[model samples]
Target chain A: MDISAVNALPYEDFVNIFGNVVEKCPLVSAAVWTRRPFVSLADLEAAINQFIDALPESGKEGILRCHPDLAGRDLHRGALTRESRQEQAGAGLDALRSDEASRVSRLNEEYKRRFGFPFVVCARAHDKASILRELSERCGNERAAERARGIQEVKKICRLRLQDLVRSDNKL
Target chain B: MDISAVNALPYEDFVNIFGNVVEKCPLVSAAVWTRRPFVSLADLEAAINQFIDALPESGKEGILRCHPDLAGRDLHRGALTRESRQEQAGAGLDALRSDEASRVSRLNEEYKRRFGFPFVVCARAHDKASILRELSERCGNERAAERARGIQEVKKICRLRLQDLVRSDNKL
Candidate 1:
């Protein structure tokens, strides 16, 4: 749908179109709905990012926790939403061979152990090797730094999902 | 670290060297130590797999949970064991950019949600895209079937790690 159509949509309908960009934080869409008539996709994404960025640490953690581990346990069982499934499928994570899966799992475990949460990133923009490389490298960051980085990653992910949900007047 | 050398090492040393081949389940290394006299890497790997295969469902799950999500948060934070890091690095999961990272996280979430555990696969055997594809496909399997698949994947992972731990008599 276009930006105007998205703005015109009712509360639930607007959320229905966009709420899932953040996995557990469905209310963000409703909040975004209040700031309707976005000038462009950039405007909408920036609003969404601003709202999330302004949240307290606890709130941010909650949003972070809502996401699953990359190629972690959840995907093995077919439990993701349709959008999430398609997102992963686009990057080929859906057909990992045995060893690549293990590498992904190993990094995930170490990252959570250190950071108290999963690493967040925009999967739509990367491939498997680059993800692993980043995962392997990012865990070295200080907790605060990683947390900040994670927020940025979450923004990227949300922005991409938003783009998918709305056919922007101007492309991202 | 040839098999003969691995076989000859003292008990503690043996466990120390091989203890973490299976992610969370460190006991495998100790157990493997007791069943020593490994003539080749294949013999050592076979014994480990056989023991794991014979475990009860709860035991299997316990071992499974010990592993992290593929391309998950831990990798980003540099939390993987050295062996895990190298293995993942070998397969290029260490360098995933944003979009691929998202795909892995989504697949992991879906798989765990359905199977009550992360999707297990041998990382040494596949590239990132293949890993994503397999993860997407495997999540559809029946729970029992998926469990069996996970166990096999675990075995594959362990074997690869073991090879790294023990210099193979003949390269794999």
Candidate 2:
């Protein structure tokens, strides 16, 4: 669609298009919806902040739903590029080595026990070691703070994904 | 790892970590890597040119690889998220809509006849219509320019994916 046509879309239509993108990925939806019709990319970002502020309790749950179980297989959806999946899964499994896996298992249990959800992390960017370190560290956060942090992280992932998606489409 | 440990790593290490993230998504890496080793989050962004200059060619290719084919089902090896393969495949098939399909088939045959590889795009971010638009638009470009542009777009994608990965991992 023309950039001008995109500009002409009613707020609801814009929302609808954006909403379609985000709906499959609630974390993305929350992040994108957090920002509406962006006059400039900067404005779009500010909207992300506003959207995060407006998040409902249920929205938090929705964000959590997109995450795969920690160290669990079948976490990803499709044929992830060979290198990306190898890196993420290798890092996750490495973090869970021998006793570490048990510890992670216990932590996963505790995390779910406390927050009523799986421990979610956007695993795309992390290395095997760094991810392991994070898995161990975040296991210590108090429930409320961790939950809030998780939602925020999801929001960040969504924003990045949106930008990536748009840029790809625009080939800009 | 402790924040200090992260800080302690050589800049190359940081680049390596950052490189992995961008391998699948370049545009994000391009936007965010503009900022470096932020002492305070306040001191984050600087300029894009320097950071881009600092990146290796393989790093650039890694970013380019994150995108899905324009009409193919495979996600780039560097792709971080679980893109729906079923969805992408269905969409690819859909793009071959009778008239367009024949044209695409003819183009696919002609293009492959001329070039040794399949046409590629980061399809997850695009809808059928926009992709079709791009396919037709790109058909007119000179072979060398199209290859160059295609490679460049891939790099941008890798950068974006890398940034997204880093942001997610940092929070974890």
Residue-level lDDT tens digits of model 1 in A33-148? 55668888789888778767755554465456566777866677988767667777777888888899888888888897787667887788898878889999998989879878
Q: Which digits, one per residue and each the tens of the lDDT, describe model 1 over residues B12-102?
A: 3555466677764445554455456888889888877776665545456545655667777667898877767776787788888889888
TM-score leader: 1
Per-model C-alpha RMSD: 19.1, 19.6
* Interface RMSD in angstroms for candidate 1: 18.2
After superposing candidate 2 on the true structure, give the runs of residues whose Cα lies further than 4 Å from its correct spot: A1-36, A76-106, A170-172, B1-172
lDDT of 2 by residue, B89-172 (tens): 545643366776566667654553453233555555577777677777777777656555665554444445434544565633
* CA lDDT, every model vs. true structure: 0.71, 0.47
Which candidate leads the pack in lDDT? 1
What interface root-mean-square deviation (Å) does model 2 yield? 15.3
Q: TM-score of each candidate?
A: 0.48, 0.38
Q: What DockQ values do the models have?
A: 0.01, 0.02
Candidate 2 docking classification: incorrect
DockQ of predicted candidate 2: 0.02
